[model samples]
Target: MRLNFSIKTKIILMNMGILIPIIIFIYVTITNNLYSNVIKSNIDLLTKESYNTQVYISNYIEKDKGVDIETNFVHKAPLINTYLSKKLNYRIQIYDKNGDIMTDSVANRVTLFDKDITNAIKGNKAYVVKKIDGNIYILFSSPIYLKDATLGCVRYIYTLDIEEKFINNMFIIMGILAFMSILISWLLSKLLSEKIVGPIKKLKTVSQKVTKGEYDNRIKIRSGDEIEDLAETFNVMSESIKDYVESLKEERQKQKKFLDNVTHEFKTPLTAIIGYSEIIPKLKKQSDIDESLVFVKEEGIRLLKLVEELLDLSKLGKSEFKIDRKKNNLKEIIEEVLIIINPRLKKYEIEIIKDLCDIEVLIDKDKIKQVILNVLDNAIKYSECTNINIKLQIENEKVILNIIDDGIGIAKENISRLFEPTYRVNNLNSINNNGNGLGLCICKEIMKKQNGDIKIKSNLQEGTSIEIIFEGN
Candidate 1:
């Protein structure tokens, strides 16, 4: 298992990890330095006292005019030790040339034979600081010289009771202050952690709600930082998901309606074919049989046409259904569409007016031809107009092809649904019309796959204008 810590706890731990060691190191260093300075000050004082006492005893022996200076100093050792110890307010000791203690100011006390005393007897001055019976003191020793002759040594033992007490009090005070500083830092860390983690907690809660399909809920962080930017991004993602789901639902409904319309369209022609076949066998007259047979053939053709258009509509926009877009003369393609649709135009007694422009564009040649044919067919069958105009031109760096009719135009409401599958204006269902309502739908899909678009504009009884736009090469 892994351990998980909250932001607040981590922040507190991090502060402690940084602060505790520093506090300890500073405290130890300060305490050691204080002790060293105090010890050094006492050593200096005791050394000075030892030097002065050595000079006083040396002068006193010199004035005695005795050839045995060692004997004279030994006899005067008690007096010198007493006088100097009283003047300096420190304990003192006198040693002979043999490193033996001759006299001490502290009477009947145990003689301390230490390294400092031995160094003084060897004609060198030295001092040492040590603890004895829980009391700290500095022992300083100096060699006493008389006219370059070896005499003896004087030693001083200075107590550091006051300095030790002061150091101890300072250590205690610093420790308490350190504890207080740590406490303050911990509290501040808690507050700071809360300030940082508060918004994050809100973000987590809102995210959980979004996971449960609550797309309307949004974060409201105003920190003016990256966290706020993240909240904005999260809101955008939620909105996108909501929109995608709604589009899917709408698409599913459209699919259901498309299926129902396909079934109805197929059933109508099939029902007519079946009915005409049943009547043909019962009819006795030769004309009647031929007429019935003709009806069957017509319905069969209509049904076949519907199936082919449905197949074309289904393949558009699918990955496997590729559109081979290449540079082609759009004006020539429009002429080809007019030629193919010429027979139907003449049968309807409709006149064609052309305003063609020479321009090349990137598009699938056959698909553009089909889209053009489908639009012209719709115009011939439903527009009820005398003349259909075909125009191609380059406008604003785009190749635009327009097939407009001055006929009984569609309503504004119906124009919007013109590209929808099986959507008809005024429900124009008849044999001559022969529309399964997939022509415009197929045209729209083809234009989209070709990286172009088709749009329609119409007003009831006025006219219909169909615009096809493609990027010019």
Candidate 2:
């Protein structure tokens, strides 16, 4: 079973676990030892005093041959006890050999030291510790011997009130000290726990802020420990997250720009198709009517192509839009494209110089053909080039197809944005041209999906070169 205790709780529990037992053990040990030593020392003192009194009685009995031992003890007991009480501070008692109490300084009080009395009757010295009426005492008993016979026994009763009171006062002081120790331990433990847990808490707060979309928030801790290292790691993670968020924002803005461009591009072709179709029936002269119908047909075809490109782009975004990969001839693909655009090239007085390599490459044949067609079309549209050079070569384990043209080249500024969706170069010479600009964007997307890429390099008034790079066979 796992107990999810907070750091502070765990710290306090652990500290107390160690400290409380130690404090109690020390207090009990010291108190017990002191009490035991005091009792032991007091018993020793009483034993010696009782022995001296017994000797005095023995000598007194020997000197007076006719005196009654009990009567003599009775007479001398008051003075002896008075002197002992004043000098040594203990009560004295005398017991006869038969265990009869002859004298008790406590004034006929019942004896609680029966075990001590029994031992004294056996002619053996004995002592016992006893508590009576909430007060402690030690009773020491010693036998009196006269000529190989037990005459009487001496009993000493010492009150332990002052010793006990002293021990209790010491106990109170120890308890107070223990409490102070616990307080200090608790304060230090808390301070240390906070120091250790502080950085983690800051990290949690900052991480939550980042979770709530505050990517800029970070923890700054300077404890110079593992937690500081953790904080530094957290800060790095925050920076990475911030960078990722920034990239996402830029991508979103680009997508917005693409959508706006799409709107404009679609609008232009639809408008042209609509306008030309509306004007065709109103023309009377045969030449004017033919011209208008031709324009209408051209715009209609352009619109259809634009729609197909948009559909293809959308399908490629889905998981199910897979292409047929087969071994295809690059030479044949180029020849086919050239044949398709042969008439248009001838009409523009453009000559194509093809240096084709007959290499079999694994590719989506149709998609690659589309890319070539788009690039060639762009070259024909914007450039008044009389010559276009096409070359396919294997280099550095890759197939590179280069198309060079001497045409109205793209400006340096427009080269970067050329392959973006619906982004067209604004040609000052031909602003009236109806180019939707989705062609190159579609080509680029198709190449990317096929694990290939397209790159264009252009110089204004000089020429443009388009390189299509693909994995070599």
Candidate 3:
């Protein structure tokens, strides 16, 4: 099984992992040093007192000439030790060369010589710690030398009550301090973890919301760090996904409508052709039969044209439909399109106005020409205008071609869907145009492939304007 831990918990654990050992080590080190110093201080005091006693004895022997150390020292030992013990606040003992206790300040008859006494009698100083009656004590021993003669040893037995209490109190304080440090570390780690993980939690929440199709949710963080950058990027991703989903939904609606329109367009022509063919055989008059044949032929032609336009639209929508782009004079291409569309213009009694600019650009000549032709044809067929204006110019480092008509124009609401496949504005001019709605759609796809775009502006009964933009030279 996996162990699950929040960032906050991990941070606290890591801090404890580092601090606990250090606190323990510091406590141990400090207490150990303090105890050692206390013991050394007591040993040094005893050595100084032992030296003073040795000097006092040597002076007394010199003052009382002809007096031996054993007789004189033994005679003054009790009084001297009593005074030394009263001054030093320690239990004092004097031992002979044989390690026999000669005198005791505490008046107890103790005969056995311990390690400290034995070492002192060997003409060396020594100290040892011992537990007496559950109380700690330091036994310090020093040798007394009288004019290069080893006279005896003086031992000081000092109670370590004060030092032991001080050490114990220090340990308690350190323990409390360690606890406080741990507490502080936990608090700091918790705060720091919250600072880091707070934004991440918001991101996770927003992500969950986005998964449920709530794309408007966003993270608001301003830590001035990578987390802030991540939040910003996450918000952008949410917006993009929202836009893409909406576009997909819109495209799906358009597809459904396109299918409906295609079915209706096909059905109308097929119904007319089928009705005319069936009725022609039953007609009695030759003139009626001829008219019926004409209707069938016309419907057949319209059906064939619709099929061809649908095929063109399909090809344009595919990835394999590549355009051959080359440098060409845009003015010449526009004039060529006008030449092709002139017959229809004459048929409709429509006058054309041209204001062309000689601009060179990289484009697929055939595709660009076809786009111009489609727009002009739509204006001529649907706009019902007498004058169609064609203009080419450069704007903002881009070549722009505009075709405007002074005829009954499209409604504002219908302009947005003009490039969608098989979308037709339900107006009188649009109904009577008899042009497949895929023309403009194909024009749009071609422009897109050419790294250009098409835009339209229209007002009811005023006119329509088509703007085609291409990358400039």
Predicted model with the maximum TM-score? 1
Q: Candidate 3 residues 143-225, lDDT tens each?
A: 87676777778788889998899999999988999999999998888887887887777877889999999999988999899
Tell me the TM-score of each prediction against the true structure: 0.41, 0.40, 0.39
* lDDT score for residue 350 of model 3: 88
Model 3 lDDT on a 0 to 1 scale:
0.79
132-217: candidate 2 lDDT, tens digit per residue: 78998788888877767776677778788989889989989998999999999998898888767767668768888989988777
Off by over 4 Å in 1: 1-5, 198-473
lDDT of 1 by residue, 271-345 (tens): 556656656677899997886677677657767866765665555567755578988988888776554444456
Candidate 3 has a TM-score of: 0.39
* Candidate 2 least-lDDT 10 residues: 428-437
Q: What is the C-alpha RMSD of each candidate to the true structure, in Å?
A: 36.3, 38.0, 37.2
On the 0 to 100 scale, the lDDT of residue 63 in model 1 is 86
lDDT winner: 3
